[model samples]
Target: MKRFFQSIISSNSVALRTRGLLLLSLLLITTTFNASATCVRKDFSDSGGDLYGTSLRLGNINLTSDDLQPVGTVLATSVVNLFPSVGLTNPDTVMFECDLADANNIYQAFATNGDSNVGGFTNFGDNYFQTFFRYTALKLTNVESGVEFTRIWQKVPITHYATVGNKIQIRGRDFSPIRAELIKTDKYDPTPATNSFGCPGPSAIGYTGNYTCPQPNGYVAFSGPGVELEELGHDANLDWTSWGLVRYYALGMNLGPVSTLTNNNTCGVVSTTPLVTFAKISPAELTAGGNRTGSFNVQIKCQDGVESGVQHGQTSIAIQTSMPAYVAAQKINLVNGSGGVSYLLSDGYGTDSSVATGVGIRLEDSKGVTRYFTGWAPCDSTCASSDNSGWYPVLSNADSVGESGGYTTYESTYTAILEAIPGQTPKAGKVDATAYVLVKVQ
Candidate 1:
């Protein structure tokens, strides 16, 4: 069973920096003065004295008495929030609990109740389903900049566990009072003499204080007994005995057990692939003096229609060609020992112009509405046309690529009609081209 865990891990490794330009527009100053006496100029280089003039010609230009002030407001500053406001997309609140996977086999690997399936006690490590206490990967994006910052959390601890008779069980419960280490923040001081809650600052990022934040900065350090949750492979699945539900603030330095990224049993299914082999395409005989036509089918299957549990559960598939056109030889490369043959792809089923459409690719939904794969207009109910290319949906269960859907898998076949341009001499070598397909779920 390939879990979506790795799929997200691969996607999360990518850094999402939301570039924002907070321009502070300044107020322009314009002043006018009235004159009552004849103007006289004074050069400070020669003498320093008062000039008897309504408007004084101070070498470069004229300046009225109103234009000069002995003292003026020198500087003004205002507080600006550098980091954009970020939090859970679904819930507006700051606290929420994450549920671990319900699969029995996964829990049994670490459950210590001595169940027959119990392999032994093991702490959830990186790549483990329960890593970060199975918290839903929170998507924190800056709406204005359109860049998603880091997923809200990198790690968490198993807050509670219990035993049912001879079998051990892991229950999903509220792991409240949990806080992340504050790396960089513009809120209060990095080293506060006394926190807004009247609590003193801790020595390190994960230390605990007596009082809760009067106003949360959206993150806190993991300052609690959960530090033991980061131990290496667990020796025993002890019940939640001494660890009472006493809510306190503490920062855990080391994540117990969940050390090192493990790559075990994390492969997913190849949902999309070429349906047919283009092994030995018939050579385009230039001497024969006619264009050649052929077709291949690409299988686009959404094995899992939508992501489950997560707030944003939509999935989409995007497609793009590696090269604009196919070539062979020094220009046109060969495939294995096969002779070179230049080709172009088109969406039409019958006779068509490969040049006019520019390797056209089309996608037909379940309703059979065909959309050009080259690009799409950006809009909701009404789409406004533009020249933007790429990042558009080729296949999706949702209306847009970013939307969410329920648990469902969709499948479709897109036909790629290959054409060998006429009147061009074909090079005698293998012919190959590349296309990239990506699947994204939100």
Candidate 2:
């Protein structure tokens, strides 16, 4: 009985050990399977015919929550150099194949250097191997929620590659996020006046537009307050350019809708239209033998579409002339005496003798000079009839004589004289002379 019990115990112990060993093996197998399931594969090839069947393998990598994390290792035993033959063209399309069955949740893929000393996370040093392209997370099978595999092909022109020995690496990631791929194509066009907006108008024929101004010296100007209009021309980019030619004065627009209002005011406010007229010249001054000329500019602001007919308005210029002189000549008669001497002059004509009395005189020195003098009458109290007291000098050198008591009724006669200034001359026919005096009896 003791022998039989020992046999049973040993067998049971062996059975337990065997079971333990089997379970350990099962655990190991499961770990390896899981690791292999999450790993990614990468490959490269030239889409163009220059290079053929070039292949490289990137080894197993761990899977992150939503992305596959590269193991930071390059599995390919041989390093290929492709820089000499073909250069990278569509770098973003390099293919990356993942082994995982559930391929949907991949979000991003990144390239990193492979040199161990270069480290993994942040040691993106030059010594490390780098991937040529990466892909965004894309939906694969409905049953899976991560990336299954991605195919990227790059095609380059023959001239682009110098030789066939170029090689590039690629790595991928898997995540539960959506990924987007971007493609770009570019083209350039260089034809002006191709579109309506780009078509510079007739004024731009000779490169004239808002952007071009005529030489200031070539044109006359009369711009209004806000009525300046710009010249038209082409810009640096061959685009049309123009500007406003404004006027300094206020312009009336009473002929348009803008000028009509309930208010009694006549001032007009309207859009500005520019019109230029050739300059006009006028005779400003004219003399007997000389002439003067003047010039001015004219500009108009009218409604567009208005007829280009005649416009009427009035403006004034000053007119002036120099003053003229007049002269006359006459004969004088004098009575000398006991009674004061009396004198008289004919009023140029003996007709109505009236004794050219109280003559007034005016003298103009030269062509441009003018002067005047007044005459005085004799006083009654001082020069009574028989007393030779009231006589006064008539000309600059003449003496005063009076009534009855001065001489014994003598009839002495005096002559009258008229003189002219040294250098003063009169206008053609404007000189005159005459005289008058008082007489008394004893």
Candidate 3:
């Protein structure tokens, strides 16, 4: 019976081994087929059209629809108080005790504290929160353990949102019962009546000293901190006389940190009068000359625009005349025996010439050679024997001529004079001259 049992066992073992091999072959074949189906092909599209399959991996492994979870929620409750919350309001500074570990864990804090999820969790750890209820990155020191940590945070100050009588949210954290004290600012009166320049004229004026506005006249009182009177004036047309509330703010204070609230004590008021300006030009006097010509420079000045009470505008100068037929003339004459015997003359005077006068007379011989003479001469003349007859007599007197009938005269044999004074000569053109004159008379 033992031998038969062993033989049966050995046969069963062989059969089992054969069956296992078949099963392994079938599994391999099935796996190969599945892998081929999953492999990317030239024409194959991914399950969701995500060519890179990133969305597929994320959806399948990390964010499966079946495993979806709701976003975390957090509740923060705190309160802070600000002092000197009146006048030129400043931000309030308040200290908050937060768990260092929790603050450093940006992901946990944002998820649990209802804080904003900004880029880079590291930045959240570095910056903290402020009394202005705004998130800010800050360097935090764990005093309990002497370890330093950074976190993005926000604070709630008593003065924050006090004007509207609403509580400020700190990094989405809620606060209640915040206490704010009214701050006393140095009183500033910008009233022109109180200023050295006195009340503003019909013009714009600058602030010189600590200006104050009278309480009853064209002025309103400020009640809360962070109110901007100057900005209010700008919006209200610089008329501070109206009895309504105006927005007021300080120049260099940070609006976020509660610590800046220390500067709230400074305050100022402005008059309601609107700035005005008036200007005029001096009347001009006209002058007349021989040609009905005259000119005057206009002077312009403002009556009230300048701080010194004198604002001047640009002055324009121009000239005007009515005479178009005005002209000028010069005279000269010709002479002979000084050189050649013949010359042609052309006076600078044009057709408008009422009278002709010589400028320069040229004497040319029959050969066309030329000589020039200037100045006037009397009539042709003859010289007496006592006058040394060998010397030719100047043409000033006809009796001084050496021999009057020796030379023949022709109509073309006249004197030649320049019609105009040649100012400059061109390289290949006629010379240009000034034919007109300008005169100034008082």
Candidate 4:
């Protein structure tokens, strides 16, 4: 009888305990868990490419003899087709974008001067400005271009979307039309581990996957951020030969949806090179009596059958030729001249009441387009308005180097003349001046 009574009590206790647990489980199911004084937002379904050790190629840029001597030389660059859609390709939808942050998550801002390393390198070398590091700036936007980007990750705390298109190409008082020299040096090296993010030591690997940006001479860069992410497009290997000590910038990716969104763009980015030759005769003495002519040419020769592309650093692409300098004098930086100051008279020369003896220059090509220039200002900013220069859309004819209407390399010579200012008296002062010719290809 006592044993029976004890069993009944045990059964009652087990039943009661089970009922209590069920009630508590129901209550817990409705309540949301939160960390101490913080909120963590996460997407459980986001499966994307690894941000660590990812290198998307941005086509190699072969440095000219002039490219190696500069402190802040551009390692390489290519046309970044960011947000290239006619109908629904605006910024409303979530698209793939290149992350500008380094390991520390720093990026560029705006500037009046050409300097745009505003985020400043921290962490790995937080705010540490070394030799090459000091001049090694990564700029994209400028006051002239009127577009800028602030600190960013794919999941931005705020909406820092650009109004038109975000660009890493540097511009300031200049760069009205020139889109070259867009360096993306977004700093974010906030770490103690040199392996993850820091300047490379001699003979040591600079990046995680063995792309050493050697110190003192070399610096690292990221892919263009504003490029439009796509699921399918042209695919070509980047075929550029890296020159000098400047190591190639490894194209990286972001975590989560950003990487997921850029699934195809990461593989489709190519570094293509077009043949641009300039028989530049700058510092040529201008005579009031005659015109000294110089020649500039941009020839694109391709493999007979292979189309042009950049992903593999190939120098094969169909390009249109134009005098990009005349169109973009404010932003054109020659290998051996001061930018935005071309043809502007040097100091010590008085011109209060002088005739419009402004340096005279003329540009002409086989397409029968001619444009003239006289001095700086009132024209430098508005010079391209009257640009009727011939821009040839030369297709790839390299395979037929000597054939009918096709040469392995189709070369065109454009004449650039430096003469006295038209209808103006020749000044009696010195005639030492440079007429810089900037050849642009599309």
Candidate 5:
């Protein structure tokens, strides 16, 4: 009886273990089915009535984002080493490609001076400033009978005011932006008008619907006064290089793609180099108990590409002398010579000047406004009483400056006078001093 009971118990245990394993396998299968149900691949679905998969499309341009920027968008440093002057061509060329898939699409090309007037680097008016754009080649490769065309423009006058950097805030003193139409033309007229906006208008030679102009004997009407035939139209012909140029000014511009092909119309925000250099410094010969006058100029080249926010008003220039003639307790020490001589330098030269004599130095702007230097001063309220002097600011707190083409220069004239104090005799040697001028943009 014990042997029979042991055999039945072992068989029952084995049967229970087998049942548990089967349940676990069913649970795993159910879980997997539930998970797969949540995410179905519709790409291969039969719900469309067709067992075959749907068509897939993946289109991409040949150029990268960075490469497209220079061709289309404007940046803060959007400087193009283009046109040296009116009627001249840009030294650099910008190249871009178009997909045949994008054929028949209209595109716009533009450039703005970023100012009110259509000014170039030389500040010439928009009437003279021109921008030339053309394609080296145009090929529609997808088609078996691929269409090939080229419309080359030597120069297209830019009329619109545009900027690549921060927008200009000043009124009237703004730049106009120019826009040229990139029209996919029919071979009927390969070359477009100067400002062509695509054809089949009320003025086009072939007045028909849907850009289809039926010209007699394939004669394409040219734009302008008087009727002129420019080209012969052909069937299934594609012209990608036809463009029209127009100009206008604006206080600001919306930064985005100007055409389907380009990302943005602002790029090449190149800075022309903001610089200040000592143009001319006059040497001085002083006489004992007499005054010596000299002048120096600091040239500032604020190029056309300077940010609109960086106007002349925001520029600061400071002038300081090397304390060529130092005096302590009525004893003057010459910078290049020995012995204490009583001497002083002043921005004031004439008797009517407000800058006190014996003051360190007076700096002036182009407007004749003056400020006292603290380099070596004790003469005026603007001057420092102590020997620890500071640089004199040429522009006043209330002053605002303007910019011009090429370069703007600031001149500071000073007088070095030797005044003999009590028990101090004038020295007979060369009186020399060094001055430094600094410019800052706020």
Candidate 6:
């Protein structure tokens, strides 16, 4: 007997698709997929079957910017609301979706390089990669099929992100009614966008638009007909007379191996790295004060703890365009960068110094401000802690590094300048300067 649709077949393949032999009974879809799963998922036609297990993450994800917001702001949801696990035998299967397995760097931050599981996704604010980066993933809405899933407030070192969805299946094979399993709860269990798929912030305050946000990491809302995770499988064809509640992002996952950057060439080591010396000048005191000033004090101390899924407190001190072209032709950026006001300096530091003409050593930060030799100064959260647009921030409580393990320190006081290099004249012999600081961490 074992009758569950008893057995079946039918197809035409490709129009968008309508191929037959839908599922259930590969020994009950390999005991509902759990073969060492940690998100990613497989087993539609069985890439070797069984492998489905997710973890929404209850710890670790304190990257901070006050959890930045305002895009659609509902950053981290999914503590529960998984459906489809009833007296199974193929109940039209549904639930479980994830996205951004790596997305590939643009400057990719949060948990270093990103996504060992749920730590990424971003075209970021907009050069129009399409502006993604919302709740790192998990956007479903299947309370009997109203279909929804969205994101908000949670820019982190996160983990777990579903969209195409699965994990509570009833799969293929059907003959309709033979059902009767009431009281899945005592009563009034509305399923939330009223229960089964809710992330409507203010802790789901009674369906629809209920707003209020300042973001300490709290916000969520989802309307309807949504589905834009692009790739990462789970609409395993049930067609139940008209594609059950409809599904399409093209079908079953693709675009894997986004990148973690491998192959023995390695990098990342800080037990101690210091070098900030500048206090001596002449050549008529640099064009007789056309601009001559010097200041130095950059000391960083870390005794332990800061590697393992990376993302310790904070660290973002940009500007290091692989210098050495005689300190990259006297690096300068229109007035402290893109906001321009005219700025340039730092030209001499190993690789055999030779270009120290017309004076250049303009690096500032000690309230002297001025810094930005490259990109990043608009991700949001009010530019985080601005040094000068492009970024020169060092933060992580207990004074820097926060919690990875043991002691931490961040001291920086560097200023050397006089601004104004239109026609040139601070020339001399040896006023050595070499500035390079990229350092990014979550």
**Residue 1 deviation, candidate 3, in Å?**
99
Give me the displacement of residue 158 in model 5, in angstroms.
Answer: 70
Per-residue alpha-carbon lDDT of model 1 for 402-434, expressed as tens digits?
212321223444444333434334333333345
Question: Which ranges in model 2 have alpha carbons more than 4 Å from their true place?
Answer: 1-103, 107-115, 118-442
Would you list the C-alpha lDDT of every candidate in the order shown? 0.22, 0.19, 0.19, 0.26, 0.23, 0.27
Per-residue lDDT of 21-49 in model 2, one digit per residue for the tens? 98999999778766554322233333212
The lDDT ranking, best first, is 6, 4, 5, 1, 2, 3
Task: Name model 1 segments beyond 4 Å from true.
Answer: 1-270, 278-315, 323-406, 421-426
The candidate scoring highest on TM-score is 4
Candidate 3 regions off by >4 Å? 1-361, 377-442
TM-score order, best first, reads 4, 1, 6, 5, 2, 3
Question: lDDT by residue for model 5 over 11-40, one digit each (tens)?
Answer: 587888987898899999778766533211
Clashes of 5: 36
lDDT of 4 by residue, 84-179 (tens): 112112323432232334112222221111011112222113212211122223332222243422122111111242222432122111112112
- Global local distance difference test of model 4: 0.26
Give candidate 2's TM-score.
0.12
Q: Model 6's lDDT to the true fold? A: 0.27
**Model 1 TM:** 0.23
Residue 113 accuracy (lDDT) in model 6: 7
Q: What is the lDDT of residue 55 in candidate 2?
A: 17
| Tens digits of per-residue lDDT for model 6, 323-399 | 23222343433334332122444444223355455555455667766655432111221213344444444431113
Q: RMSD (Cα, Å) of candidate 2?
A: 52.2
Name the candidate that leads on lDDT: 6
lDDT of 6 at 280: 59
Better of 5 and 6 by TM-score: 6
Where is model 5 more than 4 Å wrong at Cα?
1-289, 303-314, 323-371, 374-425
Candidate 3 residues 1-442, lDDT tens each? 0001124334587898987898999999778766533111111111111011110000000100111111110111111211122231222321122222222212101000011111111222222211111121222222112222222221212222211122221211111222111111112222222111222211113222111211110111122122212323232112322122221111101111212111011101111112111121111211111111111111112111111100111111111110110111112112233211121223223332432222212233223434332211111112011111111111111111121222211111212222222221111112111211100000
Q: What TM-score would each prediction reach against the true structure?
A: 0.23, 0.12, 0.11, 0.28, 0.20, 0.22
